[model samples]
Target: MAGVPEGPEAEMLAPNLAYQEGFGRVFLVCAAGRTGERMRDAPRERLGDTPEQERGIVRDEPGETNRIRPARLAAVEED
Candidate 1:
């Protein structure tokens, strides 16, 4: 899950859906704010940069490579 908001809605819905689908792990990639703050409840290992950032490629394990290209953030301003 990416950019999912941090609140009761995400807290309640995400785990339930993951459980129903029998997902062993649920990876949430949210911004560094409320979501990051709330994630303390779970055991987490944080990365320095987000996956889409230019320096976000991680090769921790010998054969495991997580390569993600940089992506632009899309937003709309209220007029």
Candidate 2:
């Protein structure tokens, strides 16, 4: 039910299969290299910030520690 995929193709496919098979929520955490870069660049809505605004904020952050702080604390923090 829970394991790492054998490769990229498997990683992409597994979440869909898990969702189709009735998993309430399927999360594919690809946090390395190109995958991580793509995800970070991808637009997402948060705290009423538009995609453009979010992108700008990302660009303005000075370092990785600042960049990742919001994401790492998001689930636990109310705001």
Best by TM-score: 2
Model 1 steric clash pairs:
none
User: How accurate locally, in lDDT, is each candidate?
Assistant: 0.39, 0.46
Worst 10 residues of 2 by lDDT: 39-48
Candidate 2 versus truth, CA RMSD in Å, comes to: 13.8
Give the CA lDDT, 0 to 100, for residue 11 in model 1: 65
- lDDT measured at residue 49 in model 1 versus the true structure, 0 to 100: 33
Candidate 1 ranges with C-alpha deviation above 4 Å: 1-6, 23-79
TM-score of each: 0.22, 0.23
Give one digit per residue, the lDDT tens place, for model 2 in 1-79.
Answer: 4665666546555445543344233323334344643543322212245447545555554465556767868956865
Stretch of 10 with least lDDT, candidate 1: 65-74
Q: What is the lDDT of residue 13 in candidate 2?
A: 58
**Total backbone collisions, model 2:** 0
**Against the correct fold, how does model 2 do in TM-score?**
0.23
